[model samples]
Target chain A: MVQRGLLIVLSGPSGVGKGTVRKAIFKEDGVDFRYSISATTRKPRPGEVNGQDYFFVTREEFEDKIQNGDMLEYAEYVNNYYGTPRSFIEETLASGHDVFLEIDVQGALQVKTKMPEGVYIFLTPPDLKNLRSRLVGRGTDSAEVIEKRVAAAKDELKMMINYNYAVENDVVSKAVDRIKAIITAERLRVTRVLGELDN
Target chain B: MVQRGLLIVLSGPSGVGKGTVRKAIFKEDGVDFRYSISATTRKPRPGEVNGQDYFFVTREEFEDKIQNGDMLEYAEYVNNYYGTPRSFIEETLASGHDVFLEIDVQGALQVKTKMPEGVYIFLTPPDLKNLRSRLVGRGTDSAEVIEKRVAAAKDELKMMINYNYAVENDVVSKAVDRIKAIITAERLRVTRVLGELDN
Candidate 1:
């Protein structure tokens, strides 16, 4: 009996170490996990690989996919469209590979509305002070932007009520371990196991 | 901020290796786990300790505890009463130690109705044949009794639908690992973490 893979949605406020934890999970060998390559109209960064990091697409193509109902969830930010393609996730899960979707809180909420069965995990910082320091350490945003992010994080913390699990990113490895445990436990869920065994 | 420990309820059909996996978990170090000692009117066999293996009590005392709403769940089998006391489980969880309740399917269902928040895990054999062999290998029951158990296991498999998680006991170590993962994942539940951090 082949078990269908899980759709795991991971989200948190900016600079909560979601990327770090995700990288750690992928670094481990033998995990049947696949990152859902997002379709984005935004230009790839210097180190980013098209189709690998993100599915770089033309603005018109992204909009066309949305129009065709091909996008699972999509949003426009800074005049660039970013969204998850429904077909890739469906095909990957059908092939028995767990798909990880790392998006913002808003985008995750959108995905939750569409795929309520997906595992929703909220990554959190140890505390507000740690979050501010991490955002500052990134050196990607101005101080004003950092302050705005901190304010937004406080609001995001409240939104954790909507998530099924909350993993604290105190240590990157510990956060990854917790997420891995969640995935392991999710695979053993009676609904999934019964369906697999019944076959 | 202390996160309250989880209440983990484990139940499966007889001879499914629940005891083995549980013993393996307790043998591991650094696990703050407490077993919920059950109250039973049955006389303790050799090597059994009061308040450890079973809380031996008179039939009248057991009935009184049930009447006083102290028993979490209780049952009579072959004129012997076996039950879990409500206070011990509550106190253990309140003191931040995860309490493990190892019981049968009937007792687990009864406890579920009383403590809906507990994590319910159903253990199962790889197949009916394996279950039969395991029951027979125990050398404690006759062929007739083993047949009755095998028939009952088929019915219990259907009850898996009502359980939150089902861990297959194909290998004792693997089952223990899955259950530990479950406990780790449950601790990261959004409600628990949020409440802990809010304090």
Candidate 2:
């Protein structure tokens, strides 16, 4: 029996270094994983490819997919539709490669309502101070915006209870190693293996 | 808040090399773990130390411990008492060291009833043929006994559903690595970390 891949949902507050940890995980060269791409009705920005940056589609096309249940989860923001394409995730998993959905907590919870079996992991900053430093390091937001983010992070920390695993991103490499262990352990889950056998 | 240790129950079929995988896991440095020692009323064989081999005790003493609810689990074989002591496991776990219980499926399930939160892992052979060869290689059992063990393994395989993880002992090192990953992941469980915070 062939084992199918896992659908992993990674959620965290902004500036938690999730992207850096994920990059480190992929850079290892042995982690067979793919990032889930979102479909959006919003127009692509400059230098952003339609399929690479986002699966840019018309509002009608995105709504049609949602109506047909092709979207894993969809939401309308600023009159633009954004959703996870179910077909790509299903296809990638059928091909025996893990798929990662690096979504926010709200979106991740929405996905859980649709696909409850997916592994939900929370990446947390070591502390709010470190998170503030990281946000400042990015230099993308004003001090007021960083303060708002820090406050929001406190609220998100409470949501850690909703996750299956919580890994502290004190060190990017250590955080990646913990996530890798989680994926490895999840692959050996009895329910997953039994499903393989029954196939 | 300090994180507590994990109670890990490792169980599988008789010939599945659970011991070897566990040995390899412990042989690696930085894995702070201890094996649960059982108390037995059976007399120690030559070259077997009382504390190192088994906690050799008189039947009266062993039965007294069981009567006092000090035994986590116990069984009688040929009028000899064998049981896991509760005090040592609690002490080891309190000291923040993972404790491995290498027992059969029956014993593992018994422990689960007492400690429902322990991580239960099932170690399986790659295939029935390999399991049979392993049983034969033991050279301690007769052909009839080997056949009985093989049949029992089939029954035990079904019990994998009761476990959290099922690791195939195809390569000893690989199996050990999977178990180590499980321990690492289990330590990051949200509930476990939450409890630490509450303290």
Q: Stretches of candidate 1 above 4 Å error?
A: A41-61, A128-154, B42-53, B56-60, B128-154
Quality of candidate 1 docking, DockQ: 0.42
Q: What is the model-wide C-alpha lDDT for candidate 1? A: 0.85
The list of candidate 2 runs beyond 4 A from truth reads: A45-50, A128-154, B43-53, B56-58, B128-154
DockQ of each: 0.42, 0.39
Alpha-carbon interface RMSD of model 2?
5.1
TM-score of 2: 0.83
Instruction: Mark the 10 consecutive residues where model 2 chain B has the least summed lDDT.
Output: B127-136
Report fnat in order of the candidates: 0.62, 0.59
Worst 10 residues of 1 chain A by lDDT: A190-199
DockQ of 2: 0.39
Per-candidate count of clashing residue pairs (backbone under 3 Å): 0, 0
Global lDDT of each model?
A: 0.85, 0.84
Error of 2 at A113 (Å): 1.1
